[model samples]
Target: MTTARPAPPRPTTAALKVPYRRPALLERIGEHPAGIVAACWVLLLAILCLLAPVIAPYGYNDQDLGNVLAGPSAAHWLGTDPLGRDILSRLLYGGTDAFVGIVQVTLVAVLVGLPTGIAAGYLKGAFDAVSSRLADIILALPSLIILLLLFAIDPSARTAAMITLGLLFSPSLFRIARAMSLQASQELYVRFAEVSRVRKGLIMLRHILPTALPPVVVNLSLMAAFALIIQSGLAFLNFGVLPPQASWGGMLQDAQMVISEAAWMMVPPAVAIGSLVVCFITIGDAARDIVAAATTPRRRSRRGESLEVSVGSVDAEESIVVAPSPTALLRVRGLGLSRAASGTEPAAPLVTDLGFELQPGESIGIVGESGCGKSVTTLALLGLLPANITVDRGEVVFDGEDLTTASKSRMQQLRGRRIGYVSQDPMVGLDPCYRVSNQMIETIRRHSDLSKSAASERAIELLRSVQLHEPERVMSRYPHELSGGMAQRVCIALALAGDPDVLIADEPTTSLDVTVQHGILQLLEQIKRDKGLSLILITHDLNIVPALCDKLLVLYAGDVVEHGPTLDVVTRPRHPYTRRLLDCGLHGVERGEPFPLIEGTVPHPGTWPDGCRFRARCGLATAACAEPGARAVRRDGAVIARCITVREGASEAAALVGAVRTIARPVSVIGDDPNAEEADRG
Candidate 1:
């Protein structure tokens, strides 16, 4: 009989929460006063322009000599011009010239500029240099003279003028696009795609364009505002969009003829032109600010309902009801981090169902290959993750306080004061321009109530503790001046500056040589023992785990395959992945012998088979292993292996049949290899 499945645990923040009413319209208006005001004005003008025919009392060109030079009256409001046309009617219809001309010019500019700029930027060399020189020449020429020359050739040619104006605008757009693309091309993902022989057009469209387009879009808005003023000015000079069309400039030209007799004629059209122009300008400014805000880094809000607040209550009446485990100094339960989905792709889990605990002075090594969410997990713990990534559902209890639902201020207080982080690349982590002491002292001052001199002394003391030669000299030196080993040592010293309780070292020795790596690891071990600090060492090299970590957490394809005592897991691994990793390690291999390799690569995100994430690469795959949920066999206290095949033993004949059916990549398995075992039981 099939047993019913248990429901998933509710997120701590979402479990206990009340629904909040949406913000009122006035509250929203108060929050962004300038933006709302500008938006309203633009919206009002657009409505007037769209409904001009219905709103206007009379036709734009209607003439009545009986009311010539009439003042503001019931018959003809705002008086009649020299030609006896209603000024209000003309003012209402005048928006068409300003709106349509700017729209056409901007459209042509984008179509001509966007692709050409992206191509030049991504595929740089002779083409880019030639385009740059041509753009420079065009930009250097006087814009008005250029327009006059075009008008001379075909006077009254509105379409030709717009096309020429668009061509003039292309160079600036091209420059912005090229600059943005150059920066985007250097990203690791773009380089990887290029190495994989992806099409050039696809790379430009997918990778480079998204990053480049925002600034270009902001420029487009500003350009529209500027184009409107230029279009109206040209119309006044009788060189832009023609007379009898109710253009702003044509109205102004007509008003000038009756300036003395009917000064009121120009008031309506002048006010209309100025107000509309100001609205467009305001809109452009607002658009630019929005782009800036979206690009800047800020603390991400919790997207879903919160589960619970901190276990440690601020009030005396609400004391902790559920006591934390004796061994748990830091406990992470149901930890799942994911980037919110965009466009066509669904929300992809970077790391999911991740749970672990760390005791004071205990080191747990998070082992995984690159791109397996090793660094992402560490970032999530410290709340330093990028804007797109967030803690989807989890509870991080540090010293009885729940961090998942903590405010930004609380997270900031905990980050450098209670927790310290050391990254993979020391050079990237350290600023190049500033001397090491400036950065260290600033950090110390920011976190602690130490004077400048006191912070400097603390920095020097920490440097000396890290075994750096001449602490003062090292502090004075810039990051670029230091060697790889020296830079890493300085980084360790900086992490120690705050006197933090928990120290997280994320692949600290990855970039160094063997000797240097050994030194760094030794330093970490020494520091941990001296300070009695809780250390979380994240690395892919399993060899270091036996020496550094007390507990081993083996991660494969973002799934923890096996976790137990470091020595026991290393000597005799139960999971297929854990065993395979041991077989591939260089520990037992002699100088002449080749190391063992797994059959296939780890599956990409969203590509793994259901039930077992490792089933594709596991040699012990069977029909039972392909079932829905992950199965775990408990070995000892908090020690388990997630493998269905391990729990149910199979006969030799059955193993052979299972292997034939579930081979991810076909290869002959030699019987002589003693390590070759069938997909079988625990």
Candidate 2:
């Protein structure tokens, strides 16, 4: 009897709840010994501020004329101040006032800095320019003069003076927030969220803010301490608090007045100021360390919704006869996409009129030099293009559904469920903050009706499938802890979590060493055979395609220059660009003598020629080749090339790429060397 079909998988990037998670910021800060001690010191100061009235022997302004300037005793602990007030009482009250002022400064600074910095980073234009300049002006102003001017306006305007000081100090935090936001905005994970259909607000909260906060905290802590120190200096100069109302700065001013007669009076406020500053500095250092060790996963456990998905199976369709070329798993017809026009910038076509077909159990390679839209096309397929780029005109039909018109939710469901993607750099494929087990298990559980334990088991199976032995140990490690090959294996395992029908490997072996490259290719080949899944491989290397790909599409300037059977295209390349890639070698400009690859670089977008983009570089380019329709040439119901020399399967073009095949070239990258380590299960 025929078996039933499996249930639909859960969203890959959607709703991954950790069985237990670290309270991201606190876990990093609280676990460190230095951080704990620093935090405790700050807490102790807060406690003293809160309980000042209950703990003090007398009120801040209460004077005992009989105990004037008295020494420490049962009646007057820590002696009496110049006004004959209980010095201990005044000190405790000063702590409270100082905390209040510090809080006021910090709150105002953060309020001014965070929004401006985050806005400037995310929204770059006139706003960024204006805000950045405004911050520069603020930073350049004489901060003490500004505070004194505020005091001059109103002698008792304590709040106004503190607010002005806070405003002046904001630029330091602004700079840190802006730098961090700028860097975090460019991270691969943030970009991944964009393409994954994650809401823009959530992207800021989850990815952008997390990275920006640590440094922001560090700068803010130091800024607070600086504010306190400046306030103390101003008070020492007789500019603040106006006496009676106790403040640390005011107390220091009093101590300075009687320093010769009662030197011990100066010690208390001085020690308080110095110790609090030290605590802030220590806390800031701890936060900086947290930022430096970002790869270390937070260990503080948190309760969250269970990510385990519970899917139900349905009966499978009756078996039917399969057609040959008619069963295209994915079809692209006249696919066009481009970047949106912004301000004076006009829209630039990224990938235009791109068409391809993939059958089950088939591999197609999209090859070209850098900037040829090979990667862009794949991003378009998964609805993962950047904010600037949009799908203008295209029909992406996958398993009968038109993906171009699919809802963001539907598109998200399609990603990693039916269509899996592996990026160029394996290191960027995973989030730096999570361990392999956490990421993999979350993905597995989210896509299937499996508990954490069961999902972990599935993850181990996937690791084994990807040729990564010791899956248990590897899963427990973070992304930085893994080697290049191991990370790539983990990435592949992640792609397989949802049991996708198609896998798109985008230059998987770009930076990988020789042995690793060949083994990864062999592993991919093994996967294709075992899973019977279609593959879309994007690469710039002409030599590597034959190892796993059956069909080839040579892209140039977002146009399909040449495409056909891999053997036919590589052996008898119909385009000059394809032939040049074979001639120049892979390194490009580094091979010496004849020089590797093509001499000139790929033309930038919007600067491409009206007819053929390669016309400027092609040796055989003529007037006829510059015609309007010269960019693409038709051959037997397929696009053969965009060149005048449209020869099908010619031996002349084959010799350029084929000669390297007979030699020892394959043993490293494409060839199967017997001594190399092979997958055990395969």
Candidate 3:
């Protein structure tokens, strides 16, 4: 309901269209050719290294004194090192150690740095001050000097040295995670989640962590290369893996010693280390590109482009706009819409001629099925219709001021301050970019003279008034943090921020479960009783009318087919469409008893039949209804019926409803089975 529904006539619609999609992991990875090739090579290298013991031609320690310095041959494919060890075997075995060390170092850095940085950035205050200083100190320490000290103390400290190296690498990761976390924390999505009542850890995992992961992944890849280089440097200096173990750095040292004697010796280890490092960096770049490509395109369809009905007569629903009460709190006189022509699409009326009155402290439900103009009518009152839809004729008079012709500044003054709005979805309604406290308090202060502190208290009071628990706790949470019911309540509280006289809720309970819907209805009823606030509710649910609305307006195909007192209308609806709406509503039927239903969907805009708009679906539609000018004829003061049969000649007490059996009739679509419904339910 966030988007305005198209009323008849030329309503606005979007001009451009684009599809949105998120590519899968393998698909994203395979998209980059060089990245895929690099990934394959890295995978192959790891597999060969892990299987070194079972597949290598000879043991890394099996010396071939006779083949020493020999080129590729049967005895040794990659010649021999200075110690006469097989170069190929050494290379394979050495990779196992390099692979394990790189993974270990990278994991340690990510585990330690990412979380700490996130905590410092998000939790701030004392934790921020302390962690930031600690990271700075760690960065300041000489990494090489500390490792040398450990190596001097124990030469076989390979595991200890790599662990120390990971620690040394962590500060840089910490800085990156911290900066990214800081930026992510300020995002509206993040604040709405936490300030509205979400867990800090969940916020970190769902929002802040995801935001920082891509860059952190690239950093981690580079860190892996750094570890390999550091491991090679350490082993070259004889401080890496001891003689019994194969180390790439130690192998490189062996190759360097014999380089002048056998220059080919340096090639194997040099290529291995360099190639693996390049693979990691390339994969990192691929990851960044994949994410960028997946997230860029956005979709926004024009809500005014309504579904069309294939079959229709030469004309549409006859235009009608009823008069309004001059002294009412708000009077909507002939509010109609027509979509402007665009491209090849012709100008057409979707919703035309709607008029209603709202008295002080009264609740009026604009009842209708989907596509019946309920939502768009509400949007029209707010002057929030889509760009392609224009108000062809109407005057939304609010307390003597015509809002339809009101300036932007004038409308802004009345919107949130004098006329609060609760949208269909509470989560989307709340501007969560700012923290809950800040957003609520600011809105409260905007229309009032309350101080910041007082406004903050008022925000909590508003939440409590809406029956939300721990209002204070909710103020610190984000949108995703709140439950469905909680989200609705949060929306209600925010709408009440300005303490406006009128509250316009558009299908507020549409997405809620039965229990939650009842709770919301009760809350609204209580609010009206306590505050004397006039409520203009837009809904498809008729059951809510008597409980909340003092008056009712039954709309169909963008026309008000019935408008009268809630009790008078719901108890005995005059229009056939309104009667069908009540019959299709929830009833106290036992199991196996079929629930009533309307056979066909609402006709598309500009496609209603010549006479009555509901005639196409009405079971009692007579040939007389086909006449073009059969609009609503007044029955009682503001009470009217669009059905021609109930015109000037009808008695005031004459039953407006057709026989109940007519409403319970079977599907009338050309091929639909009349018994299909009873069979399914039975």
Candidate 4:
């Protein structure tokens, strides 16, 4: 007779009650000189521009013949222009116009160009080709000529020039946006967003757009400087402002006639234009430096403080609770994804007829070799696949909503709220420029209607909940200042900020040291128990699955070959891919024993065979195995194997099991060599 196992202990309330601490943005600002300086300069300029009307003594274009060409004096500081206008007054007024024009033009360009570029880059092929051609045509036209032509026809030259500038600059913006979007689209975070049932727009805005912003922002700054120069150039050419409109460019145009006689006329406005341009360039340079520093990888000293905090107490005897009568939280049925081929042959399907069901609070581990469609499957679920391939036939149902047809806004609402994600590379997943506190706060505020104080408090609590030490201090630090382990923990905290029901962790601890990896896994386990959160853990390492996952899915060449309870799959894998993966985990070996390796590389979908996707790699393949459909064998509960042969002799099965088990034992050192024997004797 079999005895049933005891139920797992409920997570203690004390472990769930994490104390809140306020985030200190000021502390982070103090540490970053470049960011502080750039911010200060921008703030100062904004204030000055706002107060320009109040501070100036006369109208920007006010004239006085008596003060014409006057040198520096108490009433006319820095001297008067040839037109007798107060140089100081004109400079102040000019700044206001420049600021307005720069802001308006840049906003228009970014608003229009960013979306267009992101769309073109992310959705390549015909769309990309058309957009690229259009961008090329627009870029080829001379912006000045277009502005002049529009201004001649329309009286509102300012608007005409602004529009012309936007049209001219948009192509460059699109190119940069597209390039950055393409790069970010490949990131695991983007993949995580896709798999998390997040909408494309939210992923574009929160994940892809933010990651794409660094380069775009850098370009934007340069463009602001360019916009100002272009405005001045237009004014100088007599195309910008008509007479009686005192712009710096207009002043410069008039000063050219009297330069030799009244050199002071040319000096003042020239200096003003040069100084403003210098300020923008300086600010841009500093911003570029800050962005670079933020993205730069730092060598974290081992002596720095560790972020891990112990759970109040861990009960070793606590058995994990496997939810009974589990209901599906996520379901993927008849899913297929494929990329179009170049040659005459039919397009290749990357994922074909893949299906899976995730129950609430269940930890499902996805294990596979590289390029086995594990990541691709997750991406397709999230609607984050690359533009080339299409989701041929499938439905991803989450909380009764079919995710495949979910709108961008709906997906955004679900992401970071109902579903959170932790990626393999935390650094890529995180925004480097943001402090840990800010990132956590943003994540919380994105989904919840929390006040700043409340969001900050929650952010700190999440940092502590993730077992991070010095939670307050860590909150004040940027991503670059934190260690790899610390950053990953911060990422976990960010994911947890929204109190999501499901957390999809894609190799969350891949780059961490062994000790940190174990601690992180423990934190995940502790959190799962406390929150009753479900997890879909995507990992190549099977060693981690036994400790963290209850169910396992083995994928090869984008198909689910074997799936069952974690223990059962690990102990007795029926699929060839599963057997190879298990064999790879066994370390001990006799001298001269042949080390096993999976024979062929994963077949590229473009050249994939018509039969079983894995038949090429299977040693047990026969003529019958070349059939179109997979043979399903059902075992205990829902355990299923999609193989042709599952009725092997008991002895044969035991021999295979014993072979792997013998190799699983650790090797002992023997006194074979003289040096070993001498050392032993000593």
**Candidate of highest TM-score:** 1
lDDT preference between candidates 1 and 3, better one: 3
**Candidate 2 lDDT trough over 10 residues, lowest sum:** 312-321
Predicted candidate 1 versus true structure: per-residue lDDT over 254-277, tens digit per residue: 888879987877787788767666
Q: Candidate 1 or 2, higher TM-score? A: 1
Misplaced by over 4 Å in model 3 are 1-326, 343-345, 432-434, 636-638, 647-682
TM-score of 1: 0.64
**TM-score for candidate 3:** 0.51
Candidate 2 vs 4: which has more lDDT: 2
- Candidate 4 is scored at a TM of 0.50
What lDDT score is found at residue 560 in candidate 4?
71
- Give the deviation of candidate 4 from the true structure as CA RMSD: 22.3
The deviation in Å at residue 500 for candidate 4 is 1.2
What TM-score against the true fold does each predicted structure earn?
0.64, 0.56, 0.51, 0.50
| Segments in model 1 whose C-alpha atoms lie over 4 Å from true places | 1-175, 178-182, 185-214, 229-239, 246-324, 588-608, 636-638, 647-682
What residue pairs are clashing in model 1?
12-307, 12-308, 13-306, 13-307, 13-308, 14-306, 14-307, 236-249, 620-679, 646-682
Which is the better candidate, 3 or 4, if ranked by lDDT? 3
What is the C-alpha lDDT profile of model 3 across 363-475, one tens digit per residue? 89999999899888888888788888888877888899888888888888988888999999887787766667777888899889999889989999998999988999989
327 Cα displacement, candidate 2 (Å): 0.8
Give the residue spans of candidate 4 off by over 4 A: 1-326, 340-346, 589-596, 629-637, 648-682
> Candidate 2 lDDT (Cα, whole model)?
0.75
Ranking by TM-score: 1, 2, 3, 4
